[model samples]
Target: MSRELNNTLYQSKSEHNDQELAEHQETNKRLQRLGQEVLKLEAKAVNSLAERIGDNFSRACRHILSCTGRVIVTGMGKSGHIGSKIAATLASTGTPAFFVHPGEASHGDLGMITGADVVLALSNSGETHELNAILPRLRRLGVPLISLTGNPDSTLAREATVHIDIQVEKEACPLGLAPTSSTTASLAMGDALAIALLDARGFTAEDFARSHPGGRLGRRLLLHIEDVMQTGDKVPQVTPGTLLREALLEISHKGLGMTAVVDSTQQVLGIFTDGDLRRALDQGIDVHTTEIATVMTQAPQTAPPHLLAAEAAERMERHRINALLITAEDGRLIGALNMHDLLQAGVV
Candidate 1:
C-alpha cells in the first residue's frame, strides 16, 4: 500500500482506540459513583437506628427474654428473607427462634404460634397483607408482638406490643421502588436485638460453640487436646540414653518431626526435634554416636490433655514451635500433637 494510505488507516485506528478508552473510563467512574451512593444511603439508614433504640427496643427484648417458647418471626417477600436471617441469628445467639412464613401461617402454620411464644414481624410498609392477616390471630392467642416497620402509623405497628420504627428517608434503589435501605435497617435492628439478648443472657463463646458444633469456631472452642493428640502407640518416644539416630527413626516413623525422650516411668525428660538435629549436625556430631539427651530441648513446653486445642495452637504460635507433648498432672507424657494435627482438625 501507499505510505499516505497507511498513515490514514493508522490515524483512524488510533482515534477509535482513544475514544473507546475514554468511554470505558467514564463508564467505570459512573458505576463506582452509583455503588458509593448506595453504600452511603444504607449506612445512613442503619445509623438512624441508633437514636430509636429506646424504651420500645428494651420492651421488645424483655418480651423475648420472658417468653418460654420460641420467638416466631414472620414477614412477606423480601421482608420474609430478612426475617429468616434474623431468626437464625437469634437462635444461634442464645435465643430460641425460628421463621414462619406469613403466607404459610394462614395455611395451618399459625399453629406454630402459642400464647407462650413471642412474635417478631417485619414489613417495610407495615401493611403486608399476608403478615397483617396473622396479627389478629397472634393477638387472640395472647402472644406478645414486636413489629419492625418503616411506617409507625400502620396497623401492624399500632397493634404491636412494642413497635421499633425502622423508617428510612429513602431506599438505596435509584428508582426508590425496591426494599433496599428499609431491609438493611430491619436487618440491623434484628442484629441489635439478638446481640442485646445475648449479652443479657450472659451468652458466651462456649455457648455459641455448642450451638454450632460443626463449624470452625465450634471446633476451635470445644475440641480438647486429648481429642486431637496422638495417644498410646502413636506417640513417638525414646529413652534418654537412646542414640540420636534411633530418635530420628522414631520421629520419621511417627511423622511428627519430633520425639519425646522419656524415663522408664514414661516421664518426659526432654524433647529432641528436627531443629535440634540441625544444630547437632552443625557441631559435626555423629547421629549414631550422640545420645538424644545430649541434644534434646530440656523442659520443653507441655500442655495438659484437657487444654483446648485452640489454646494449644496459640501456645505453639507464641513459642514458635511445631509440636507439643501432652502431659498428665504427674508430668507423665500421655500424648503428643503437631501443628499439622491442629490444621487438619481446623483448630488453627
Candidate 2:
C-alpha cells in the first residue's frame, strides 16, 4: 500500500500488458502470412490449368455440346460439392446440367442418366468407388463420360470417353491432406468448361437473365419500361392551357414530382417538373396566373415503353433527371416512370 510498492506493481502490470500486445501482433502477422500463402498456392494451382487445356479439354466440351440431354455431374465429398457448383454454373450458362450424388446414383438414382445425356464425374484420386460403381452402367447406356481426376491411370480416367487431368502440385493445406488446392483447381476447370460451352452456344445476357429471373441482373435485363411505368390515370398530365397550380396538383396526386404538358390529341407538348416550379417561384411567377406551357420544358427527353428499365435508369443518370415520360412511337404520352419505380423493381 506504500507509494514505492504501488509503483513497482504498476511497472510489472505495464510490462505484462506490453508482452501481451506484442504476442497478439506476432500472432496476427503469422495468420496474415498463412492466408497469403494459401491464396498463392491456390492461384498457382488454377494457373496450371491453362497448360492442360488441350485436346482433352476440347473433347470434353464437344461431348457436352453434342449431348441431347442434360449434363449429369456426379462426385463424392469435397468433389461432390465442387460438382454441384459446376453443374449450377453450366446450367445457368446455356449448358443444361445438374448434380447427382454418386452414392445415391448407385442406390437407383443412376436411372437419371440416359443415352442422350453426358456424364461429368469429379474425383481427385480417380478411384472414388461410388463414382466408379456407376461407370459400367454409364458405359452400357452408351453415354459419354467426362472424367476430371488427378491420376490419369485411375479406373474412372481409363473408362472415360474424355479425361481432363486436374492434378495440383500440392494442396494449400500445409499438411497436404485436405482437398484445398485440388478442389479450387477442379472448380476453375469447371468454370472454364462452362464459359467455353457458353461461348460456343452463343449464350447471351438475355438468356442468362431468363435462367436467373429472381435475381437483380434478371430484373435489370428483362424488365421493360411498360412493366413498371405508371399507366392510365396514374400518370400526371396537364394541357398547355392549364394553370401551373393545376399541373402542380396533378404532380402531387401522381407523386411523380412532374407532369406532362399534353395537347388535346394526347401528344406530349412539354414537361413541367418540380424544378421548373422552383425556378418560376424564384422569378416571382404566380402559380394561379401562369400557364404550365410557358414554364414547361419543350421537347423533353422521352423513352419508348419497350425500352429496358435498366437502360432507362442509365439514361436518367446520364441526363441528371429523376423521371421520364414513356411515349408511343407516334409521340403520344403512354405512361410515366420515376427513379423510385426503377428502384422498387430492382432495375437500379
Candidate 3:
C-alpha cells in the first residue's frame, strides 16, 4: 500500500479530533524529553566509541577486510534485528557480510561456519549464551572473532580479538529492560564500520547502484540513454532538406510528437516538434513545399547516448521540450528519447 493509504488505515477520522489533539500535546512533552535523552546518550556512546577505536577497531577492520569468506554478524533479540540490517548494509556497501541468527547457530545452522570467515558478535552485556556457545568452535577452526558490547570485560569480549564498546546510560523505554539507545548506538556503529570499509574500497555511487538496481536512485545512476531511448528503426528522423510535411508524417507515424532533422551522416541538425507545427500553422507556413530545416528549431538540445536517462529527462524539462535526440560525441544521431520513455523507465 501507498504510505498515505497505510497511514489513513489506522488513523481515527472521527469528530473526536479535539480529544486526540489533547493527547498529542501530552505525547509531545514525553517525546520532547525522550528525544533529548536519546541525543545525549548517543553523543556519550559515540564519544566513548572514538576512544575505543584506538587499536582493536583497526585490527577488526583489517580482519574483516582480509577475510577470504563473508563476515558473519550475530546477536540476539533486538540486537539480532539490528545485526540483520547491519549485515545487509555492509554487504550492499561492498563488504561481503551476512547475519547468522544466534539461536539458529546453536542448531545445525552451525554448519554455515567456516575457517576463512570473521564472526562479529553483538550484545550489550557481552554475554549472550547462544552467540558465545559457537565461538569456541569458530576459534577452533581459526576464524577471527570481533565482539561489540557495552561490557568490554565480559567473556565474549575477552575471547574476541577485538571489542567495540557501545554502552549507553539508559533506555528510552520506561522500563530499562527494553533495548532502546543501545540498539541505536550499535546500529550506528555498524553503519560507521560499513561506510569506513566502503570508503577504503573506493566504492562509488555507481557500484552501490548496481546492488540496488530495482530502486529509483539505482535507475537514475545506472540507466543510460541506451537502456531507455528508442533506437535503430524506432527512431523517427528525416534528412535536413526533407519536406516539412514528410517530417510531420514521420512524427505522426512514430507518435513521439517530434521528429529529428539529420544530415546524410545522421548528425542531428534540428528538431521539429508538435509545438513547432502549431507555430508554423499560426505563421501560415507552407508545409508541403517548405523544407523541415526551415521550420525546425536550430541546434535542438541533444544528449549523448551514454548520458544518464535521468539527466536526459532533466534536459528535456529544462529546455521545455518533450523529446530529446540521442547523439554520439561527434553529433551522430544514434537514438531518441521522449518524456514517455523516461516515465516508463522511472527516470522522471
lDDT by residue for model 2 (122-189), tens = 99999999998888798889999999999999999999999999999999999999999999999999
What is the Cα-based TM-score of model 3?
0.86
Q: Which portions of model 1 show Cα errors greater than 4 Å? A: none
Ranked by TM-score, top first: 2, 1, 3
Query: lDDT per residue, candidate 3, 1-348, as tens digits?
Result: 899986786565543686899899999999999889877866776656666566777788899999999999999999999999999999999998999998998888878878889999999999888888888788888988888898878998899888888777776566777788789889988988998889988999999999999999899999998998899888999998899888889998998899998889988888899999999999999988999888999888988888889888888888888999888989999989899989999877
lDDT of each: 0.95, 0.95, 0.87
Q: List the residue pairs that clash in candidate 1.
A: none
- Taking all chains together, each candidate's TM-score versus the true structure is 0.97, 0.98, 0.86
Per lDDT, what order, best first? 1, 2, 3
- Higher-lDDT candidate of 1 and 3: 1
Which regions of candidate 2 are displaced past 4 Å?
none
Q: How accurate is candidate 1 locally (lDDT)?
A: 0.95
